[model samples]
Target: MPSEESEVVVVGAGQAGVAMSEHLGAHGIPHVVLERHRIAERWRSERWDSLVANGPAWHDRFPGLEFPDTAPDAFASKEEVADYFVAYAEKIDAPIRCGVEVTSVRRHTHRPGFRVETSDGTIDARFVVAATGPFQRPVIPPVVPDGAVPVQIHSSGYRNPEQLPEGAVLVVGAGSSGVQIADELCRSGRRVFLSVGPHDRPPREYRGRDFCWWLGVLGLWDLETPPQGAEHVTIAVSGARGGHTVDFRALAADGIELVGMTRSYEDGVLRFAPDLAANIALGDGKYLALLRAADAYVERNGLAFPEEPEAHVLGPDPDCVTDPRLELDLAAAGVTSIVWATGFATDYSWLEVDAFGENGRPDQRRGVSREPGVYFLGLPWLSRRGSSFIWGVWHDARYVADHITIQRGYLAHGTTDRPGLTPASGNN
Candidate 1:
């Protein structure tokens, strides 16, 4: 338990390591952070006690904090967004530490930068950052085999609907945690289903705004990706009841049962993927291309915002996408729990950094990496498209704290020709 030194270490006290320790203590640098559990520990113990905060509470917070008493368009709860990131890490006195854990990082064999190892021990950092945020490890898609569901789990181990198991649940993954845990297990009377993949439904409000204010007045949350054919979709909007419009034909007129896209569970049957009416016409064509791009950005900025017309309806098509049941059987349809809202992978296998890529992710750009001091806070689009939200991880942690204050002014001038520290652009 010795080694500890830090010109920055970070690794994850959530809300991207307390927004990278409040922009590395507003650039005076010297960081620490750590956290293997506490401070928004996955919104206080991995979500689902009727979670909330799919935005709203004034654009999902952190422009130096708010959401205390909440209500800027509400939606906060998930224990008020984990007590507003533990009151924005105690209003930015953020050095953090919280139980510590990291486990490995690599690079500094003898010296120039990161070592990190942790569960409370070796630190040695010239810079590390990780900010472990993309909801680490929960994917669950073995396609439901092991004991096939007497009560499977993951929706980060769900929580409410009286903790399942009275019969008929299923869920699987329609994103936004499987249509809000199959609309809270079909409003708790159970018998749900869900599944339906390729998501993106939008509208939790339209002309009277808040589809994240038309994705921030239609710049579309600074889009870094996911528009062109919605690359593997998934954002099925819903801040739960008070916030609405996930629809699936109004959750199949409130009876739930959606299905499609599970594709394999074998003998006790399951199958699925007849693409439930092409996943409800690909979420009604990305919810009519985000209401015709918010009606052409309110007619090219003439903006007075009024038209709702029930946000372009689309209704109808439901008996599991008009008789599209490809298969199910689980004890002749009395299922008995499953959940799996299938999403969340990002362990970084304790990050031994060749800066990752071949899709093991972290091939950074905006949170700079290609190795030099190795940053990377939060994930999702990583630079734009609300980089993992919470005011886009405080503007990508103040652009990795101004690129770690220009790589600590070229490592205090012994310069290795760092220039603007390259790695080119964003969204890697």
Candidate 2:
């Protein structure tokens, strides 16, 4: 088939796909967005009620919809963010084909068209955008001590305190989700033990500036304006999670017991790493320094303090405590539940496409891949800073949408496959 007879297909209508679809609609580009599930279903299904966006209500919002107005420093609940996404989908109509699960994509060497086979039907498209963001997969390390006393559950499967096991529960991993789950479990009066690992942290506010303000000034959240020669570095910096990035310190102040990293969960006791505190401190200090720098920048810029930043330091505390311990040995620690707030993994198995690399991740530079017109958006390190942020996908999508438009224009002028639209691997 010729490219002129095809449409553009976008896969995965999560945050990334939604942004791509909105841009395509804005550009009058004819594209259909295929989502395996309804919009915002992941957040609703995978997160608990107390789970909130890691960033403040402002930065957490996706394009086209503002979070429901709440306290200035409040965290937007998962439901609120989900509702916002739902509204965003409707606002754009976005040409979304709900329940369409794409099975495979094969590029044509004869033309710049892809035979995209989906559950609904096969549609040939001149281009395909794999906007499936990260967190599509969950990683559960099987380091649990054999015959451990707790019920193990991945973060994705946890919904409420009741779902957690009895006694002092161990919440591993200190990412946003980890700490949040710890706080929730503790609030529900469960004796909770937290295993803090290396994760980013940032203050909600710094030096009288809203968290986003410093991000804008230091060019953190200024994702639209890409800096020169800083592609990889910028992504790395943006992805850094600081203590200020989360409220673990506050949770600690609230009396949540913190422990060193679990070296191994054998003998019923989660053996502590001798340098676990050092590891936690290193990860924590980097983020703290970032928060301080943002605050310093606010002062240097001479901007009127927008909000009074809280600069109080947490009091020195014990390095580790084995409290909430059930058994004197490991089994009696009474800790029966283990919630792995570790994180998610990316799954691309359903993509029967021929455009993946050896790592199974779509082999793409930013959005453009060697696989002809196959593109992927909202991937970390895809391009420039925050390529996966709510504000970042526009740049990547525009680049891809422009490419598709060029292909369409060529096809409009009676050009079939000038130079023969060969796949990267030269398959038809």
**Best model per lDDT:** 1
Tell me each candidate's TM-score. Answer: 0.36, 0.82
lDDT of 1 at 32: 77
State the lDDT at 383 in candidate 1.
74
Q: Could you give me the TM-score of model 1 versus the true structure?
A: 0.36
Instruction: Report the poorest 10 consecutive residues by lDDT, candidate 1.
Output: 419-428
Q: Superposing every Cα of model 1 onto the true structure, what RMSD results?
A: 17.5
What would the per-residue lDDT of candidate 2 be over residues 87-188, giving only the tens digit for each residue? 888888887877878887776544657778777777777678888887788877877854576578888888889876567788877766777678778878
**Candidate 2 residue 277 C-alpha distance from true site, Å:** 1.6
lDDT of 2 at 168: 77
Q: Can you tell me which runs of candidate 1 are displaced by over 4 Å?
A: 1-104, 107-110, 115-136, 139-145, 148-169, 172-177, 180-205, 208-244, 254-302, 309-332, 336-339, 342-374, 379-385, 389-398, 414-428
- For each of the candidates, give the backbone clash count: 3, 20
User: Positional deviation of 63 in candidate 1, in angstroms?
Assistant: 21
RMSD of each: 17.5, 5.5
